[model samples]
Target: MTTSLMHTSQQNQPLISWRWLSLALLVLCIIAFASASTSWLRISPDRQLQISQLQYFLNVGISYCSWLVIAVFANWMRLRIPLFSEKHPKWLLIHCSVAALISLLHILFDTFMLGLLFSFDFNFVSAFAKKVAFWLPVEMVAYLACVVSLSLLEQHKKNLKLPESEQSYTFEQGNQVRVVDRQDIEYIEAYDNYVFVHCANERLMLKQSLSSLAAKLPDEFCRVHRSYLVNLMAVECFESHSDGQAFSRLKSGKCVPVSRRRKMAVKSSLAALHTHIH
Candidate 1:
């Protein structure tokens, strides 16, 4: 149930949705119509006579409409492979190839759409293909921007959902409740009914069970064992044994045991942080 909740939270992180896309599509339509209406002001009478009103709309606003389609792919791509990590090289190669392909397809699509606008004959409208150099670079920038925008939006959503004040604990300190920031904690240990939050230069006891506490914290706080949950950011190194047990040594000079059941998960979480693959 906790895993599913985390997965749902991730799904909601992306700001892109049907409502936003619908608004954008409406804006694109308005722009296309506005541009089509003002052709007389922008083009010379002779130039205006050369192309139909439909062709003029396609030439001016097709890229905007194309963006709506690209946004969907951007959301999918960003979710499939993280953009900012060790997978960066692979992401770049894929984006470059995909961007170039999209450029070519977009141009062809424009040319074909223009040709089929007035008649069934699709033998003409090579004019879009003529401006390949101009459109290719634009498409490259636009594609990258689309993906990056989604990534930034997701990060921003996470920040909003977990503001500094929300990412804290008000645990009992003697008789009073003492608030502590999650980032200040290096690691946590399950102390029977309560857990010990090992913070910077001090240890605070939270009157919460480890399992319940684990569900409340961020993904960075990985459960390494039944009794130990080490913050992946604080994990300096990991040592494994042939017998299946392992240990995560924190930067604060404390070694936390990694149970055999959760060993693979702990290793994977650390690897994702680029801490250690071994």
Candidate 2:
């Protein structure tokens, strides 16, 4: 599982990098369009088009630099705590607060750059207070949209790779090479540096980490514990404990302990299987 996870992660590195680049380009396009429209209306008709264009570009260029910084920070935060999958209400509040702060920083940075470029004098406190009222909502919406779009794109990519995930897995034991269908596996148990693959009335030891194996296994096989992976199809029943823990009883009558953290997932998988049957 670890190897497969690492491999998937490695494959996604380029995609992630491309996303950042695409985001920057998208921001640039938005700024350019806004700048052009605003300049056309505000600048005097007698003024040179090049001069108006240059002014607009400079203003947007300074703002874009600030936006780039904010984007990098937001992207980093998204990677660590993805907003799309976040279920806690507190995280929503935190993200809103962060978005407000980002907007404030963007205005401040733009103001600094504009002041340095064209010797303009204004009260910083009043300007910041005024801009916050106008820009906060806009920035918040943009941030949320960006996050949602990226999340959807990621989901689409994963769906596209589902067929690849369904391919059979190969395991080697000494001189014998065994090709196993993912559906035939009942459960897998981790022991030291090796994992025991339990299939129909036979158990085979493979010199691989459970995590690495789990990554390659089909979606039907779920990690119920740090040391065990249970085939949801093979799970005939679940045994619950008073301590909020659970165990999955396989078709072979072997019970696999489900960790506290995985109890809900195990239950959900079982429920899904039951639903599909009906």
Candidate 3:
């Protein structure tokens, strides 16, 4: 390739070799390693005695390096087919198709590279052959996780560009800006970039993630579920099931699920709200 052609090609190349990308990925890997080390009980016991710390780190480093390309591809895929679109069925199909394809490709590529580097026989096919069933689910889960995590980061960036108010929420809808009072909201349900705001008798939509919206809201709002943010003032009662599941029932008779992990927090919040009211 000529000099000008080489320069053009470099400009079009992927971000794998970028210094900032490397540093960010390294930090992510370090955090992952530390978390895994601390949560050893969750790890497979059989693999613990078999793999040395040095060997484990080397393998993790290699996996993460290759995952950088996959991550870039995931981000590209997400932008091409946004998380929330008008055609819900079509959107769901496309995401599933892409995720499956990526998972298979990642499994094959990662297996081949690992075999080439570590295995004596270098038989890539046999390495992940019988384990396709085993590895496919793991890779598919990883791919889905990657896509959702990327969406959060992408949403965070979009939030930074938008202006905020202390007492109300403002969201731009094309040329129109919709501002909703914080006190008027009964609850907020998350749907990717779109949030459905439920009032006493009507529901409205806003173009913002629940996380960003929750951050700006006052203490009256309580996150009862991953997808739900309930106004403490609107809650009629809190229900705790014997099966360990819990729910927040709003005065409007709407029941929002409270995740098992957040049950205690939800109980405490409700008790505090009740005490304050009394």
Candidate 4:
């Protein structure tokens, strides 16, 4: 069983690696195009361009390299500090603040590179002001475009990995092992050192952690609480309490309490499911 799980995980490794590689290649292509376009625009027939084509390419390359570094950092930060997550109530404010800081850093690096390549004196305040006025909007759009595209790609990958109805979950009970179809599972709850798997009319106890089982389950199985994993299809509706508590009411009339931390994520998942169904 362990070997099978390991094999499945190994199969997924290459696809995950490819996604990152694709993102990197996409960013490089965008940077190259932008650099070439900007450099071409600098060469005008009517006006005398201050910098040569080689110098302009070098400057643009430096600027794009700086942006690439910033983009990598931003992606890392986005993973750690995910905006628009339930845990992040002030996500918009935090996102805006981070964008401002990134823009400032981008402008600073770009200016430094311009000065280095062109041997031009940079007035810090004036340069920053000019960048903010002219470059910030373009930078913001580019940053958003990259992030959004990568995010959509990730979602597409996840959708492709969604478990089929025939997929089975294996568990050990006492000295015997049993395999249960995923569609047969109503919900899973953690109790002491064992996890209780609730099915249509049978409840099976397995010596496993909820977290471990969650990783193997499909997207339909959501972690509504620290100790519970509820199949979204089994959920009839969500029950609310005056004390700001909530419970997921399953079709079997079983109420699974949802933790405050996971409520928004669960709600979003349910909403997405609803939309998909309709």
- The candidate scoring highest on TM-score is 4
Estimate, for each residue in 1-278, the C-alpha lDDT of model 4 and write its tens digit: 21112111111232235357557756765776576567657756733253455446555665665567556655644544454556568855665566667777777776765565445555767766887887677666666555555556545645575444336666555565666776778898888877888898778876667777676666778889989999899999988788989999989898999998777677767765665566
lDDT of 3 by residue, 1-278 (tens): 00000000111122234467868888978876675555543566665343345345545765686567566666656645555544344866776677667666756765765564456546666767754676566666676677788666544542443233445655555556566665677888988767888877667776667876676565567787899999888888889889988888888788988898777666655654464456
- Which of 1 and 3 is ahead in TM-score? 1
> Alpha carbon lDDT of residue 232, candidate 4?
94
Better of 1 and 4 by TM-score: 4
TM-score (C-alpha) between model 4 and the true structure: 0.56
- Could you report the Cα RMSD, in angstroms, for every candidate shown? 10.6, 9.8, 19.2, 9.4
TM-score of candidate 1 relative to the true fold: 0.46
Give per-residue CA lDDT, model 2, range 1-278, as digits (tens).
22111122122223457467757767886778677657756747654574447456766765565556556666554544454332444756666777778887777876564454344555667766776777778888766666666656644544554455344456555555666666678998999998887887677777789887776555567789999998888998999989887899988788999998877667755664464466
* Candidates 1 and 2 compared by lDDT, better number: 1
Each prediction's whole-model lDDT (CA): 0.68, 0.66, 0.64, 0.66
After superposition, candidate 1 runs with Cα above 4 Å error: 1-18, 30-51, 84-89, 117-128, 149-164, 168-278
- Please give the lDDT score at residue 37 for candidate 1: 62
After superposing all C-alphas onto the true structure, candidate 3 shows an RMSD in angstroms of 19.2
